[model samples]
Target: MTGVEHEPANERYAYSRTALARLALSDELRELADRAAAGVPTTNDMWAQPGEVVGDALDLVHQAQEALVRAVIYERQKHTSWEAIGEQLNMKRQSAHEKYRDAVAEWQLALQEPHYPAPSGAPVRGLRLHEAAYAPTTAGARLDAWVHEHIPAQRETEHPVTGHLPALSTAEEMVQVLDALNHLYGDSRTPPDPKARARVIERKAALLDRIAVEQGRPEAAQQAEEARALAAQLHAEAAQAPD
Candidate 1:
């Protein structure tokens, strides 16, 4: 893993230091503002306090979300096959591929985007965030927190569609890209082999078949059939190939 993929924090510890730095900086700034405002007294909101169990837990959730997304990014960069990734993730190959394919593609686009110097003269606008703005107007369940995000009573059901999107490169090219990414991100864990992966898929299908029969779920049985078919194909492919 790149030690400090994000500024002022290291990924080795999942950016805990960086999150703390942000919290401390925010509190200092709030206190300074309180001293200047005269009417506004500085108060330690639960969300802003260091060593608060709930705050740390929330920050950890934020860290985990980012890490999960980045893990998908790193895996894609290595050009790891969806099957292997799925095997490791304990999900169907298609499910894993479908879940992360778009997000990973977007991340690749972002990394390719150009960087620019920060603008001067703006101390900061609003607050530094540790997680996705679940409620834009709220201070996130703090005692003094207020909701800023307005939920309209009615919203449009749909919008105009966009242009056709690009596709991931060929499998060979994707693998090459992943290797390049691995150089930067550093991959140490081994992915599942074809035989092992096939077995996993087969076993899952077997379980699904049993569940389908017992639970009387036709859909589950259909999915089981599909999984079995895929597993058989994978076995055939592995038998013909050299590891």
Candidate 2:
């Protein structure tokens, strides 16, 4: 909720695919911890609120299910086939597709538009079902905070949760965007839209330019230049793409 409250207007379009996957894993882990805490049996003769406990446990189950859907979306983004997904779920391909088709389609739509019409006909941003739940900036911070509180050992040990993940920064965000674009548009069976790729490359170039100016780093400036050149090349190729 704090993430939603504090999201900047300009920076609230789409989350990188990596963020979605990480958020899904974190959410599932958090719910599992909650369920474990709730399942602790009453050892002493204390006044146990059985109804409240049961309700909390049920809620955790529902939350875990939602997290599973997020995980499925991440898999789908990687071009994983429905048959593979169904095999893992111990069900038929059609059954798995029918179950998750809406969620996957909604995710694809949100990635492109990232906004929906509000009741008053105003376009609302970053409050969609997926964005509100897993905005990259805040989601990463929230997970780090939760880990420190619930899994302090992660901070101390060489655990992937903390060890493998780099600190959240503008450069890190750009890198994630590039990585997601690679998975979506790079060497895939489906023909990617060159214009769309060019547009993203142009944006990356602009961001890198901004970073170079603000950071005054030679490497950043070089990256910015390279990105601009690549973007120009992409635009030229896109011009040659079939209409």
Candidate 3:
């Protein structure tokens, strides 16, 4: 005959008893009880009627877990003592040490893998909707080449006509570049200043003249002359305005 030994019921209830004692007088416990009474169910089973909610909750949990794992690995990698790590994480030092020992070793080994460069001219992957809409691809051997051709060269640093104008300070250059960029990209809604607008028109007229000379187009030359005449009329009007 085999004899069976029964465990004490008090021993089995020890954890619950300790928990109740610890929480008996706490405001947190009172708040939790109040919330429970208000029919705000805390369990996943209670919210399972809404499939989307369940899925979203699961996604959040997964993201939170990944962040926690990454943080743990980072802390360990940075040579923080287990006791200090436990204090930060609000856990027992021994428990923290045990929980991450295997993960630390695994991550350390993973860090040893040699990093390889991405293939040249590889298509950009995983851009979000807004980013994809704003940044389009251009055919070039490299990103630098693409930028050089597609992005306007920093507004020919010196003005086309009067190399006499003071070199734009960094801030002024930034403002000018940003203004041009906003115009090109449809980011600006306000009308530009009248005086500045006149200057731009004059510069454009000069550029048109140069282009007409290069292309040997009689129509382009006529257009350039018309532009110059318009510019002179605008300048005369501005000069006559009361200061």
| Alpha-carbon lDDT of model 1 | 0.45
Residues forming the 10-long window of minimal summed lDDT in candidate 3:
131-140
| Better candidate by TM-score, 1 or 2 | 2
Which regions in candidate 1 have their CA more than 4 angstroms from the true location? Answer: 1-52, 115-243
- Predicted candidate 1 versus true structure: per-residue lDDT over 1-243, tens digit per residue: 111123322111122222222322333333333433442343645446465646545555665555565555556655668888899889999999898888765544333221222347644332222221112112112212211122132122121111111222333333433443443334357644556457556655765676688778899799889988988988998899886
Residue pairs with clashing backbones, model 3: none
Q: Give Cα-based local distance difference scores for all models.
A: 0.45, 0.65, 0.44
Cα TM-score of candidate 2: 0.57
Instruction: Identify the runs in model 3 with alpha carbons over 4 angstroms from their true place.
Output: 1-49, 114-243
Best by TM-score: 2
Ranking by lDDT: 2, 1, 3
lDDT winner: 2
Candidate 3 clash figure, as a count: 0
Please list the residue runs of candidate 2 whose C-alpha ends up more than 4 Å from where it truly belongs after superposition: 1-15, 35-53, 121-126, 129-134, 157-243
TM-score of each: 0.28, 0.57, 0.28
Tens digits of per-residue lDDT for model 2 on 5-102? Answer: 23343343344454555565666667677676757776732665757767767787887788788778878866789999999999999999999999
